[model samples]
Target: MSPFYFGWLRWIMVYNSSIRYIDDSLFIDGIDLASIVRQVSTPTYIYSLKRVGENYRRIREAFAPLAAQIHFSVKANGNLAILRSLSRAGAGFDCVSAGEIDRCLRAGAPAQDIVFAGVGKTRAEIAFAVSAGIGWFNVENLAELHYINSSADDLGVDAVKVALRLNPQVTANTHPYMATGHGAAKFGLTADVIRDILTRQSDYPRLSIAGIHIHIGSQLGDTAATLAALDAALDLLAAHPRIRTINLGGGLPVAYRAHDAQPSLGDLVSELIPRLAGYDVLLEPGRSIVADAGLLVAELLYVKRQAGQVFYIIDASMAELIRPALYDAHHEVAPLRKTDREPVVAQVVGPVCESADVLARDRELPALQAGDHVALMTAGAYGMSMASNYNARPRPAEVVVSESGDNWRVSRRRETFDDLAQSDK
Candidate 1:
């Protein structure tokens, strides 16, 4: 391998332990990328089950001192195999919709271990969750509380556990699109509303207001906003002695750049465990656990040179992964096969019709040609979960590699043209 290839390999390996290279071939968990492509074709999502287990165990061990419950966020990657692996490893689930809850149940997660959370929970979703005997509901507003209470009463279920989500009004150091803790965000109730609701707790006789949930946002780079939110929740807990559980929503971040300096999980846990002595703590981690565990592999379709700029067009597009188009997210692209060719500043684009379908802009990648396979690094989270079928393109398949790296299987088969129009009457 040349210096450029070595540098690229070393950079990606820093994010997760499952990615590596063997004899100039990129392998995820010891399974060669070429072998997977030969079996499942390109534009398939390949996940390392080993990495998923490792990430989950890391969080569990870090919060072991507080005996905190770690709930894997389902909105990150809801593939059945992924959820099943986490469930088997003793992970509870954090679901944002009735469909997510159903996915968890199908994946063998117990209903009592799932937490239903969302800004808008419809009456049907609440009724379904209540009937399913869900463990907790992260209530966002007073109207939601009334809905839950009424649903519980109609179902003859009493003392249904509910957590009031508070908007700490502290702006987190993240993208404005993902920020939810600020006062203007439509995620949680303000402090005054929470206080007033607590004072009138007796109004909801069927609901058990036992927890306080505060989630500032995703991809949090610092602890300032989180700590401030924690303080606010703690203050509320102090005033309301009946509230014993503190649900700290997940915002732990994963590094997209090789040199990115993200806070260590242990450091955050150390700052948190001390203040959460008497209360039950819950964490809902999504991206930090899976973002680096998987990759999106695509085959180069054309090499276009337009206006003196190089564009590597791939079979994949915003339909498969939309972070770049949606949030201007950065996901490093690496060639599956190593070469000694000098690196060039090129843009990786998809076949989407929109101009915003660029994946990586001005990235220093080895000169690639048609039929060359490339993998997008740190795409395990928000990739498949946010995918769309724009321009009538079928979505890609998903594969999971076992811990030993010796076994792999297609978890989700690629969609066909017939499958696309199956919903039509």
Candidate 2:
């Protein structure tokens, strides 16, 4: 491989044991991506179970000193196969809705291992979770608490474990849309409100206030804001000594670019374990665990040059992977087959009919022609989960490579035109 390709792979942080070059072609878990694309077709998602397991075990080992429970956040990627793989690996789930909880259950996760979390939990969702015997509810407001209590009471269940989500009001260094711990964000309750709730704990007799949950935001660059949020939670814990668990909501970031600065898992755990010596710890990690384990492979349709700008349009669009359009995020683009052609600076665009449909802006990539395939690196998390039927475009297929790196299968078949309107009357 050329230094350029090696540098690009390092930039995305996917140049690991599971992902590398085999005879100048990109192979994930010892299986050629081209072969998978040939079977599943273009605009497909490919995930490596080996990489997912490695990432999960890395975090689990880092927090071994604290004996923290790892709850993989389902909103990141709720595919049944992915859930089942993590469940079999001894991971619990952090679900934002009853549907996610059911997905986890259907994937073989025990009900007691799931935690229901969200700012707005519908009455039906609360009832469903309570009836399903979910282990914990990260309650954000008094209304949710009342709903959970009512649901538990109706179900003839006593002492449903609850975690009061505390809005620490700390500003984490991340995109404004992703920052949830700020005072202006509508995520968790304020300290004063939590104090009042704890003071009047007798009102909700069916609830057990067992933990304090704090999730400031996602894609956190360092531990400063997390430490600040933890300090705030500790202050609240001082007044209420009964709360034994502290659910540190997931914000651990992954390297989206070569120069992206992120906290190491070891460093983060080292700083956190001391403060949470006696308390039970729970971590909800979503992106850090699976983001780098997947890819979005799209086939180039046309190469156009207009007004001194080159655009390599592909079959995939924001409808399939919208992080670039949604968060101005970066996903390293690499050609499936290596080439010695001169590199060109061009924008990798999609077939979507919007100005924001560009996947990569002014990126240097190997010279390529129509029909050549490209892989959007680090798309395992928030890729398919956020896909939509926008522009009436059918979604793509999803394939997963086994942990052994010797086999692969299509986990989700591509959506067809008729399938798009299957729900319509």
Candidate 3:
């Protein structure tokens, strides 16, 4: 186990599980990190095709008894290579925009298997989803319902199959920005409100009231909170006989460190199956399906040491990855090449200018040097997808590794400045 120590944050590794999917460890089916760094230097987004498949299998096995339709939430990680790999493994999609919908379709997901969802969907986006014959629209409010009905009617189609995303008035013990279950949040409607809408659904002939949907939160860990939300939804589903499907929205937690007590999806499925016996089950897992399977490889540009601090600046910035900047998210940080040092106090930061662009703050880990490699662990989901183009820095490139398979393919190439300014004209 690799022990890391810092003033405030230190990863005490009980077991040092080797980084997979990239060239970090020497294994029967692992890419060599030194080789990759030799080719693509620091700030590269590395994905493990093999681990992605394992994650999909884990979810599939979890909901095996029920006809679990696993929809990979694209908002987390929307790389075409990753999407195509999961699609080939029988994964559907939960999309939030027309561009995502189009990307899913291009990645080989059938329109009938995709679910379109978002709060502020535009008219053109609505038209585009309908035109694609998407299976369902997760309507967030009454106005969207009206817009969808009008759009479907204009397209001369039958009522579009839809699910009302229920905002279960419960507190998911997570960050406020990521939590959607709280009653006061603006994501979904309450039970009483959904009931009101169901009564009014009769007025809109172009809308098919098909299912009940609610996403409690993102990156949740407490079993009790998740089960409570599921039980609450089950109670509502049992009371309302018309609802044909029940979507226990995504947000299962993934392990950032090897010792993190992340529950198996099987445990969750086993506990919730009894309550959800008859209804068709829909699992919209985003993070659990891709988090561990990916890694963010950064090259150590320069290592500075002062009185009591060290700064390991890498090529990647918050503009290339936003979880650190947005949620103050914690991803395990480690030196790629083994180094000799008891431990040193250091901060793992990026090249971005903002003070909030910190990745790992106050940590004690082995010494790093210029041209060394460090990895940001548990970054598959929401890592690449949440990237921005701040500071005029182009996003980093992404690649995937598989066992006895393709080593690395450019999932997304870092854009050139000319490419960025091309659309301005």
Candidate 4:
């Protein structure tokens, strides 16, 4: 084994077994980072297939004795390889767009196992979903309901199964941008609005309310808001006993820092599974399944110091991983190699031309130099799925490390400048 150093000058070998250092180099799933960077190149996304499977099994086992169905949220990672792996494990899909449906289909997920959820689905999108014969539509508003019914009628399809997304007004103490079930959030329908829709259900004969859906927010550490939302939905169900499904949308938080005290999936299952008895339940889990299983490896390009403030610039930018810049999200930054130098306060910035391209600020890491490697931890979720070709920069590639870590396959090849210009009309 290599060596491990934590802030102080002391050194030891074998840190976290999942991600360890051997011969002063980081190894993910037993694959050396120095070799991966040399072959796959830096600024690449590396996912541990074993870790993902472990997470999936953990969630499955937690809800096995309960009436729950695991629907992997496609918006979290959306990589085909990842989707295929989950699909093989009997996990359904929770998609938000026509494109996501297509991706899920391409990933070998059946149409009956895919549920589409979104607030602003266009008429065309609704028609596409109808054509695809998706399982259910998590209708957000009356307009969407009407549009979906009209589209189903136009396509000569039978009754379309749907779940009305209810805004329980339960505040999910997460980022405001991600909170969805609040009274003011532009997502789900209010209770009064839901009642109106039920009263007028006969008007849209082509739509059938098959279930109730509620998603409070992402990165939720506590279960209070989710429980409140569920109770609100259950109250509505008392008046309408025909609704058999409850879609507790994905918002299970992940621990971005080592010290974070995020609850386990078992904790959630223990608290909610019993309450959801006697009903067919659906859970849309995104980040909780893949976040901790992935990492973004970047190559340090330059080290700058000015007025006692130090900055370490890397090849990755917001164009590659936007969670930090978009949500002001926190992701642990760590050196890929062991170091004995005293820890220094520094900001880890990326190559994006914008000032908000910072990944982590006021962080401490071993003094790193050019050509060294660092990883953005817990980046498997919103990291690449939210990436863009900002500043005309091509996106990074992705590699899925096999169970043994002895074999790693490139799930996606690095984009070229030509790829960026292909859609330029």
- Alpha carbon lDDT of each predicted model: 0.90, 0.90, 0.79, 0.86
Candidate 4 residue-wise lDDT, 1-425, digit = tens: 22323444433344333566677877888798777888989899999877888888877787786757899998999989899999988889999999999999999998989999998898888999998999999999888888988898999988799999999998998998888888888989999999888878898999888889999999986888899899999988889887889999899888887666546777777778677888888889999899988999999999999878899999998898888888999988878886767677899999888999999999878888999899888899988999899998889999998876687889999999999899889
Worst ten in a row by lDDT for model 3: 20-29
Model 2 scores what on Cα lDDT? Answer: 0.90
Question: What is the overall TM-score of model 3 with all chains considered together?
Answer: 0.92
Which scores better on lDDT, 1 or 4? Answer: 1
Model 1 / residue 172 / CA error / Å = 0.5
Lowest lDDT block of 10, candidate 4: 1-10
Q: After superposition, how far is residue 89 of candidate 3 from its true place, in Å?
A: 1.0
Report the Cα lDDT for residue 115, model 3: 94
Model 1 Cα lDDT, one tens digit per residue, 142-244: 8999999999999999999999999998999999998999988999988899999989989999998899999999999788899999998888778788788
**In model 1, which residue pairs have backbone atoms overlapping below 3 Å?**
none
Global CA lDDT computed for model 1: 0.90
Better of 3 and 4 by lDDT: 4
Alpha carbon lDDT of residue 19, candidate 4? 66
In Å, residue 371's CA in model 3 sits off its true spot by: 1.3
**What RMSD, rounded to one decimal, does every model reach?**
2.0, 2.3, 3.2, 2.8
Model 2 Cα RMSD, 1 decimal: 2.3
> What digit string (tens of lDDT, one per residue) describes model 3 on residues 1-425?
44343422343422223253333342213556667766776677887777778778877887888878999999989999888888888888999999999999999988998999888899999999998999889989889888888888899989699998888788887777888888788888788888888777788898889898889898886767778877776676665788879888898887776556656667777787787788888888999888877778888787877667788888877877788778888887767655546677678889889988888888666677787777787888898888888898877878777533447666677677987788896
Model 2 poorest ten-residue lDDT run: 7-16
